[model samples]
Target: MLHVAPSPAVAGNRHRRQMLLPWLDAEGQRRIRESTVLISRVGGLGGPLAQSLAVAGVGRIVLFHEGALLDEDLHRMVLMHPERVGEPRGSQAAETLRRLGGPHLEVHGFDHRITEDEATRWMREADIAVGAAPTYEERLLLNDAALAAGKPFVDAAMYDDETHVLCVDAGKSGCLRCLVPEPPPWRADFPVLAAVSAMVGNLAASLALRILAGAGPIPWGELVHFDAARIELTRVRVPRSAGCPACAAAERTSR
Candidate 1:
């Protein structure tokens, strides 16, 4: 329930606190309301994550996906309509995000995978980034972007009924490069299920928003694994890897 501007809306400030009344103070909410985040692949995980962020009053959101909708993807890609089976996914998600956000929400839709150049370009404008892509190549790109930008990046993943989340708050929290020293090969489609997708995606948004609002310290350098089927929820600590490839370049640059 974001309040619309009374009249002239000021730049760098708008109706950002209208929806964050539940857990965020006006100041925290305003910080989020003024920040921007770039989310890759608005598919299964990214769709819900983006929806939650938009609904939570994020000031701006940019999403990228380089594919057309397919029938099989609809089970997880909630923002797409059955009729939009052949339309571009990024375009569809951009429209849906606009509807979910208040008038001040800025939306950028890119129908292409993120490259180093493009990633750096968007990363400069965004405060944080979310990696919901199914492929590790894309995830690696995001990790590099996060490392390059010195910003928070949430690595989200799911397998069957299990979901895992890792937050990377630069300089303070460990990054993806620090946790997984090597990028794992991706399956054509990852082991994602509806239940786990929702859990992981929502958790990603919650964690990202908490960081964005400066509400609490994020679970950086730590991993949270939840499996409802086995009734197992645990946190594992991962130390910074000495030979992480994606981030090694940056570590050397700073020295």
Candidate 2:
């Protein structure tokens, strides 16, 4: 079970500044404090996403990332400390989030490859799910799990000189597979910069926050892409695929 604060008003005043925003009043803050988020892989993208969610005062964060810290990971993963290079990434990320999130926030870390079974179980409990795994296999699993659980899914990926953010409302909007039916034949290892990944992570976090707080339209079927080299931002409409296997299976089961 995820531990959360009793109320935003009594949560050590960490959210005082954010509470001032019109959309994020006391009620909104309380909503944020009561929500639980699941992030897969606290690496390039998930690291910054988790940080922003923590600062925004999310109630609980369940992180799943299996691996030891690598020298390359240190470049973009802000939560991984320099001294803990040889340690487990998931444990380190959970520890850092707990420290930064303070008494009101609860963080759980699991250092294991997330199987389809595990994804389904955890996504059932998560208010929102984030896909930041290095591989497309994990990303697809997260998307399907979120669809089954009827939760919003946010995914971000970085290429050599560009990054993309996809937000889906499950049944109502197109999902990852809908956007890209199959994983493209890309290199297993890709190039990325800390700044670009952080930017994408922050964007994903913002969308998740809006969904949790009911502050604005959640960008249900939108894809936001940024060109790191040229500094360009573009938005595209993400149409739901009528024949999406994951979604179609759910629709059939519901019927």
TM-score of each: 0.87, 0.92
The residue-by-residue lDDT of candidate 1 on 48-134, one tens digit each, is: 999899877788888888888999998888877789898888888888887777576778888778777888888888999899887
Give the whole-model CA lDDT for all candidates, comma-separated.
0.77, 0.83
Model 1 deviation from native, Cα RMSD in Å: 4.5
lDDT (0-100) at residue 202 of candidate 1?
A: 93
Q: Model 1 scores what on Cα lDDT?
A: 0.77
lDDT of 2 at 86: 79
Clash counts for the predictions, in order: 1, 0
TM-score of 2: 0.92
